[model samples]
Target: MRGTDWLLLWTLSLLWGGSFLFVELALEALTPLTIVWARVALAALILGLALRLTGQGMPPRGLWPGLLVMGLLNNAIPFVLIVVAQTAITGALASVLNATTPIFTVIVAHLATRDERLSPAKLAGVGLGFAGVVVMMAAGRLEGAVPAMAACLAAALSYGFASVWGRRFRQAGLAPMATAFGQVVASTVLLAPIWLWVDRPWAMQAPGAVPVMAVLALAVLSTALAYLIYFRILARAGATAISLVTFLVPLSAAGLGWLVLGERLEPRHLLGLALILGGLALIDRARAARPA
Candidate 1:
């Protein structure tokens, strides 16, 4: 990966990391399903306008099925899982467990594709990254959060498959902006019935300005803008490099929580972050030598 790729990856990481913080805020007045719905639904609307302004046409008629599948894997399922997990765990810890996405991505890509084969360095990197999660979880005194942790890991698994699956849009000659818009729109369509059935959103009370604004940022800033950057990096850097952003996400989430929410950040958490960064460097080292 080049320096530019690293920069985009880190930028992507920060945007996604802020998702946990946004979820924290939105949860004050919304259900997990509702928040997840709004994140993708509103992002779909934002991206749709951008697509119109940029003169990007409708997605290929032949690709709707695949696009819907991509939306489910990449957005709907994991977003809900993470939001639900946040109900029981701190945003930082949820982000930490979310780091496991790369590990799962490595395994899934190995099984699903011939080109992005697994290697010792990638395996080592995954191990080291996950060890960071364990370390931070311990240091944060996070306990009795088994269900929450499980939800997060499930979300990570969803993301892992989504990374590999997303490669198709590039192969099909879709622009990142258009592709991002398509998937979120698909997500909105797919999730609409589910959210309506589960949340009965009409019956729910309005969440007021703060949470409303937080959800908008979560949708536009984190989901819409982030997916544009995501597909761009995936096109240039491949699934492995794109997925490495998860390892950095915890650090960003923790820092944001500390700064804004007054969440504690112990010295031990810093030590854990060191391990995560080392693991990401190892992943990058291998990517530098290997084919995308």
Candidate 2:
């Protein structure tokens, strides 16, 4: 990866990692469906216009179904699950569990295809990374939050599948911007009926300025800008390099919590973070050694 690629990866990490804090803030005002709806809706609006300006036009006719599936897997389902999970678990625990996405991705990819075979080192790395996450959660005192923990894990799995499913678009010849915009548009359309039936946006409380702004931030910055950076990084760097952001998000989340939410990171947090980062490094090293 070039210097610019590294910069984009880290920047993307910060944007996405800080999203937990933004979601927490937004949750004070909106339901999970509502927040996710607003997110994909706003992101679609922005990216769609950008697409139009660049003459990309709407998504191709044959791609809608696949795009909708990707949107559900990538954004809608996981978005709701994480938000609902946060209602049951602390953000720290949630973030730690969420960091397991890449590990899950490795396993899923290994199982889903013959090409992405797992090495002994990669296996060790997954075990170590999962162990680190367990240590982080245990250190953070996760006890008796079964439902929330389940929700977060489900979110991670959804993300893992989405990561793999999204790769198929290249073969489908859909550009990144079109793919992202289509996903957002599909997510918005798919989520609306459920949001209306369950959340009933009309009945939602009128949120104050801060919470409203937080919603917009999640929609615009986290969803839109983050995806833009993500696709760009995936284009410039390899998928493995793109996955490195997973190792950074928890640390970023902890930092954001300290700054914004006045949460304190204890010694245990640092230790757990070190283990997770170390595990990811090992995984990347193992991946680098493998034959292409």
TM-score to native of every candidate shown: 0.86, 0.91
Question: Judged by TM-score, which candidate is best?
Answer: 2
Which number leads on lDDT?
Answer: 1
Lowest lDDT 10-residue stretch of candidate 2: 135-144
What does candidate 2's lDDT look like per residue over 84-158, in tens digits? Answer: 887666565578778777777788899997887788888888888777666655643345476676688789889
What lDDT does each candidate get?
0.83, 0.82
State the local distance difference test value for candidate 1. Answer: 0.83
Q: Give residue 247's lDDT in candidate 2 (0 to 100).
A: 82
Candidate 1 lDDT tens digits, 35-134: 8888888998888898888788878889888889988998898998999888887898778777677677877998999987878998888788778767
